[model samples]
Target chain A: MSKLSARSEDYLKAILRLQDQKKVVRVKDLAQLLGVRSPTVVGVVSGLKEGGLVDQEHYGYISLTPEGKVVAETLLQNEELLRTFFEEVLNLDSGEATQNACNVEHFITPRCRERLVSFIRFLEICGRGAPKWLDHFRHFSLTGEPPPCDRCGEIFPGDRRGCEKA
Target chain B: MSKLSARSEDYLKAILRLQDQKKVVRVKDLAQLLGVRSPTVVGVVSGLKEGGLVDQEHYGYISLTPEGKVVAETLLQNEELLRTFFEEVLNLDSGEATQNACNVEHFITPRCRERLVSFIRFLEICGRGAPKWLDHFRHFSLTGEPPPCDRCGEIFPGDRRGCEKA
Candidate 1:
């Protein structure tokens, strides 16, 4: 759960996708999907197998173990949520959203994923009020300012001489 | 632009934040923020200087030139969008969302960023119809099934071999 790298996660997810589409996955197929070499796919597959996330025979097709299936499902859920957020909430194009989600989904932690889900729900329920605080919550974008102090909700001016007391 | 690594972007962002806060950024300070050694910071600083993104003297405090500020701002914007998406939509915890945004923001492309923004807008304006699709989407979460075919939009039976011919 905690040990997968983004690269490894990509491979696992790709395998899962292939499984969904074809019910079987091969090294060459995975390599083609990932735009990587067959050797690279082999290396990653070996790693995944060792991790108990993949099951493979000598030269047969590849598939996810039950645990692998769970991980892949979770990763897919995160990727879709992120893609939807990026595409529906942010007004991004579908292709770009998918690509970005593919990259971002791996690095996200479960806690962060939950928060993102909450934020999306708030947007759904609260509407306009959501963006106002969201704008401030992410105030780092607004002028490259230091985040407002969590305690006082005061904008900490970036160039202050010393606001140690304030 | 495409040449900067996530680590490099993090360095640039740290320098930009420091410059905004202190009006001057020292090598040791950047090293502290990045948890790297001073020599490592010096190397990255030299690269940034070569890239025309930063101004540095032999031993003087470092600062970003105007061009560097633009890049930093761009990175900050992407990070904020990602944070908002994660926190507001996904229910991810704020602190964890922020940290994940920090890690992935640098890697996202402008095209992808635009799509994410658009997608968010779509979700906001799409209204009640949105929740209906949520269950269909959640099917992917429950089962490792490929989404209904892109063309016909019919859920493929588990025994199906491929999308139906048009």
Candidate 2:
């Protein structure tokens, strides 16, 4: 997971994405995808090839090695997972979700990733029915008042005994 | 915002932290806080002094310029905000919360920071009574089944309509 810098990781990701979209990955395609010049792409690609993370054929076509594929796939999956969590759970918009996910994809540890996975799975499954307190959350976010939950009133006294603290 | 690298930003933060904690900051103290050598801290402090972000007395004590204090305070506040959000909202462990906040404090944009603030303030105020869905979330996180919210059954026809999707 820590094998390469974020820039190199992005190169691998762009290669995989371009491969699916265009069916052939070229050095120029990578440069365009990454918004870099051809020479910069050439330089990074050479380093990637030397690291055994990419294979370059005669015509400047770039493909991931098996090791590279695994790394890229892990990174891509992490990005998707983070984006989905940001969108669904955190209620971030599409642009913010994508940007935040990209910013965070390279940094999440395996433990944090698992915890996020658990958190999102819980939200996706539980929130399908849209519980009543979820509405209070919206109301609170908008109006600064939650209007007091009857159930919580019954469940606990003052100071909110059962809920976890920050 | 884009003026300094993350390493440089950390230097500013450590100087501020040391200033408040020690009342006197030294090159060696900065090295300890940043986990770099004294010479490395000296080099960065020189750059920071030239950049008008830090002042070094003849002996060794380091102090922040007014501009530097503003930047450092902002970063420290952002770090605390992120740490609190991770702890309260995400329910992460203390170690994980601190680790993740440190990893992300430098990268969040002003817009994202505002959104995070709003989200956290909502939770802090609204979740005070420990609403029903909060328990359901805990239960679902633990048991993988929400036990079906009765209120949701009446409100939602099939797929949840009111709740925002990720």
In terms of lDDT, which candidate is strongest?
A: 2
The reply for model 1, stretches above 4 Å from the true place, is A118-166, B57-60, B81-94, B107-166
CAPRI class assigned to model 2: acceptable
Worst 10 residues of 1 chain A by lDDT: A151-160
Which residue pairs of candidate 2 clash? A87-B166, A88-B166
Compute the TM-score of each model's chain A versus the native chain A and list the values: 0.73, 0.81
Candidate 2 C-alpha lDDT tens digits along B1-166: 3498888988999999999999999999889878889999989889999899998877768999999999999989999998887776666788898888888877766766776776677655555543444455556556666445434433221234552331
What TM-score against the true fold does each predicted structure earn? 0.64, 0.82
Question: What lDDT tens digits, residue by residue, belong to model 2 across residues A57-155?
Answer: 767578988998888898899989988966655567889888888877877667678767877776555555534444544455567664454334322
TM-score of predicted chain B, candidate 2: 0.82
| Tens-digit per-residue lDDT, A56-78, candidate 1 | 99998999999999999988989
Candidate 1 lDDT over residue span B50-114, tens digit each: 99998998999898889999998888888889787666555456887788789888667687666
Best by the TM-score measure: 2
